[model samples]
Target: MRIDRRQLLTTLSVTAAFGGLIPVIGQAAGSRDPRLIVIVLRGALDGLTAVPPIGDPDYASLRGDLAVDKAAALPLNDLFGLHPSLVNLARQYHAGQATILHACASPYRDRSHFDGQDVLESGYSVPGHTESGWLNRFLETLPAEQKVGSKGLGIGSTTPLIMRGPADVLGWAPSTLRAADPDLAPRLMDLYTKSDPALASLLDEAIKTGKIASGQTPITAMGGAGDPKTMVAMAEGTARLLTAADGPRVAALAFEGWDTHAREAQRLTQLLTGFDNALGAFETTLGPVWNQTAILVVTEFGRTAAVNGTQGTDHGTATMAFLTGGAVKGGRVIADWPGLKAAQLYQGRDLTPTTDLRAVAKGLMAELYDTSSSALARRVFPDSAGVAPMRGLIV
Candidate 1:
């Protein structure tokens, strides 16, 4: 007499079933239809290795064996170079479509991954306050009419906290199984329509999003969400959805498996390669829309300045954030250049953060949505009104 949610899902899988389906309406575009994407790279990224400061005298000595050879790295300028595995990013940089923000971090100073990510995505000065995320809050600040449509999108098995809040958001993840019967979806919809209108309404939206996601590679096909191999597939699917006429204007995605406490050289290579390919997918699939979009790639924190006993770096402070896409004022590395010398290091172990990650995020939001500084400080970032948004980031 009673039906379980899992059973309903299993039966629906015969046609097309989704992980998490939420109703999200679409909005009419104004004169300037700007798109923004936030890609959170989970696990600490070694900022020193990813964007090696080859020009810094202490860089080579401090990094030692983990040092990125300047000759092999893609030169960004006279001082900094991107890791060799970032081939596509390097190309984007050279084409004047990429910019790097070095020595950056969230307000949180502790090293707990769980807490650090919470603070980073939650857009708060401290961790443990997870009722809503900054991006979702930003969506709440949009004009009331904009809320009628697809304002915020979450792509993955579940919505990341960064995209969770009072605002409605569309959720999409490619189906992992083949449809057993093409007719099953409609049949179930009819049954739900008669027996339960609530479920039927949800099913309708699911079917709609499923159609939007049709022809995309499943997460399993690409080796799961956290697997490096899945990056391109995930990115391509995201582009497909974003390119849709009625798709969301802003989106959030998270990639995992970046905590490299050991075997970093080999691991980092694979990760960076996957990331490079994903960047290529976004640039290629977005077409003309790419010119109006900006992608922000960030991590929870950076790793230690020196390599550990296991040839990897430990958790520390101050990492790098990437700003890429045609909308960005590219070909620049923004940093206060905290030297790696012991005296300059944070706690004498990690790179010192000079730029607030929130400032960069706020600046982007300010430009893209024309959000006022007071609104950003009050509703989006919350507290710390003294922090000014970094300028010259957007074209």
Candidate 2:
């Protein structure tokens, strides 16, 4: 009954269900009606390889086996180029629907995946300081009667901690989601029912909420969640829901399997391919709404700059973040471009982070939701008073 954090996530990753949505019955339109999606690539992503700085003198030397050939890359301006796996993203860049944020990191500096994700999603300067997520808090700050509804959604097998809080959230994952252990659920519940009542109660609530989500509207999203093979289906299903005028207006999703400490060249290719395909599905499935939406793709952290003995990158600091969709002011690679020199690296190994991701996120939040800077700092991202929201990200 006392499940470890890792075990709990492993279990939830398989058994996905839903909770009720506070119906947005008459989805009124306005500047605030714009769509925004936050995609958290759970595992660390190699910023150098994904958006190579072909112009940097040290890039090729540091990357070695993992270096992408600029000749086959998709040109993004004269310096950075998109990885070949990012074919769809390349086309998006050309169409002015994409922007990449380089050398970015959350406040968390260590290489622990769990802690890094904790700070990234929780919106705190340090990990483990807060229990609720920033997104959930942002939802809580909405004017009680203004526009609260199913517009807030989390799509995956289990909702990311970022989407868990007071907000009335709707969940979507593949209906075929199976349990990690057929008897695990019952056994856990029984153990909880007798000993840890609080934990047991939460499990009960999730189950009941899942049932409440049944029969209202079909889980039309093809892929459901979590399974990599169904990535496109997940994107299509997300778009299907977002397109419904009365359905969700803002959503967040998480994709896994990015921890590429070995066979990175081949591993990253498949991951990027899924990412590209998902982007295409969003454009195709959302139809006209695609123009009004901006998708934010981020990872917990970036891998090391130098390739290891295994020809893969290890955990490091500073990576890339992406913003794409019709709402974005695209055709730009925004980065101070911290040099790859030994002195330039953070602690002499990873890329030194030059941008605080909170600023970029605050900027987009203000543009789409018109949430004030004061409120953004005080409510949405507490203790982040000095980190000003960025400008010119959305038009």
Candidate 3:
């Protein structure tokens, strides 16, 4: 029995690392045709370490071996410094293209990664809304004229909950696998068109997506999810897709392996370095579009302020959110600056969050999409009416 080559290729694409990243095109709504990308760093990132408060009187002693020395870190301001591994971010910060929201968190308070991520993605006051994500919900609220050809881009084999919803979304992922025979796609597409029109449409879409996914830097060269290089490769591919003249305005990507239960320092060095490089790739790849782009990097929760016995920090509350891209009003670390003193910590353990992350997301949507406060409150992030959208985040 001969197997259909098209089916086999589809199977292979799904099995590959760059399986679900899908790019969608949209018509310009008005003069502002802005772009937004949300990168969810799974495995809660350690905020205190990522952006250390070196000037705080109690930071060094509390962190001990886990502490980032002042000399090693890239100074963000007199009070806080970025992890030394983040060279690209440091460069961007100085160029006024990067902004850090320190001591920020979603409404979720528990430390469980699953629950934390659900709240972070679901845009709910609590967890368990797996049917859709806030970004998808926001897409639903767009005016019909603006959404005519618009679709959300979900980057991964399984679409992250944050991009899953009633709105149409395209999925793709980055892979090192060789492309299928060029002739095979056209022939199979013809066969499907003649007999099964539905299947043909699906194949046509897949072919276009596969073509976009093929030429980007292979994921293998960058290492796995744990390797920082992977982040750069992913960002490069994402940039390529978004820069396409008819490409998507909104994209969602998720990077894993940030849990860091042990060996936090060594691991973070590689991860942050890759993360920093990826940001540079976006700036370079997007060109003038960078001026209209806002990249939001966030995590589930944070880690404890004090280092644990395992040379790492345990899950806690309040980490940080990163907003970078030329579209952002950047170069500042926005924090209410909750001190690192034991008494200052939340429940005597983690950084006490002063800013709700929802406000940050809401703010960007409000400005970029011209989404109203009432709509954002009633629809995009239901039950979040009390949490006003943050302003002055975008240029």
Candidate 4:
């Protein structure tokens, strides 16, 4: 009973926090007042499915069962089409508030979700290269005069490693955390192990679970750590906090469950809906500050181009990047157009990455915050001198 009650409380806290009840404290926006939101899709998102390359002669054939039906895809251009689930994003694109960056990826190419996410967030050419996040370092680059002497407010339980550099960063999560007691974790884990064995095994994972399983319902049913409503509400809270004239100007959000190893068609469709809705919520909540904002959506890596036997995809390479907000130079599917033929595949299985994600980041930071590419390579993204910022990312 103790375990069950604890689990219930845990879920309740998430409900309350995500429902916009908690006010997260963060670094006040600097003098520039430019807001940047980085939403990390932890699981390997299949770029092909999210932003389908229908015009590529090999796309449909290579994708097999995992391919999004071009006829149903929302037309983005003569070449690419977005999945129906991303209706909000497509609308933003039409309004010139979004841009689709195809065949983009971080330097990490391995399939491990942990490592991929680390590389994606850490902004390193290799994993474990930095103790801090690129965003944190980006914040460090801001003129001391504009910094406003603030730290970041992470939206989840433990502060993520990327945000852990020299700069101070605070964290916020759904919790009933009373006065900090050293024995809390151990006691909770002990109780959880004795009560709910399944939930106990993933104590850390529990902190991020979108929904708790009951009865015969599988835990796998929850799309990511966040459910659609929770994600939307989280966005609402973010907008509220960020829109504050004195609120933190930068934030980091992570959403998982892109690992569609099976039944990807069904799974991805649902996840995409969540993604679309979250973006919509941000737009609605940001209000006047929307014009000064730039939201960058990126994934660790993309899934294979070819569908597996179970109508899903394996971890591959090269996916799409999404940017939306009033500050972005939108209505363009930016790419070097790597053909999806077998010979063109990264390893003869994945889409070939044509652009570096760091370059995109460089462009945004340089353009929005008046950051320079030289400084971006030197300070923000260490050893990223050769990779030039993809120009024209910001208006």
Q: Give per-model CA RMSD.
A: 3.4, 6.1, 3.6, 8.6
Clashing pairs in 1: 25-149, 25-150, 26-149, 26-150
The TM-scores of all predictions, comma-separated, are 0.91, 0.83, 0.92, 0.81
Task: Evaluate model 4: give its lDDT.
Answer: 0.74
Q: List the candidates ranked by TM-score, beginning with the highest.
A: 3, 1, 2, 4
Clashes of 4: 3
| lDDT (10s digit) by residue, model 2, range 41-155 | 9889898999999989898988998989989778897889999989888888889999999999998899999999999999988888456777777776666444746336777
> By TM-score, is 2 or 3 better?
3
Which window of ten consecutive residues has the lowest lDDT sum in model 3? 14-23
Per-prediction count of colliding residue pairs?
4, 5, 10, 3
Off by over 4 Å in 3: 1-29, 176-184, 216-224
Candidate whose lDDT is highest: 3
Superposed model 2: Cα runs more than 4 Å off: 1-22, 25-32, 148-151, 178-227
**Candidate 2 collision pairs:** 151-249, 173-224, 174-224, 221-237, 223-233
User: Over 4 Å off in model 4, which ranges?
Assistant: 1-32, 174-224
- lDDT for each candidate structure: 0.81, 0.77, 0.82, 0.74
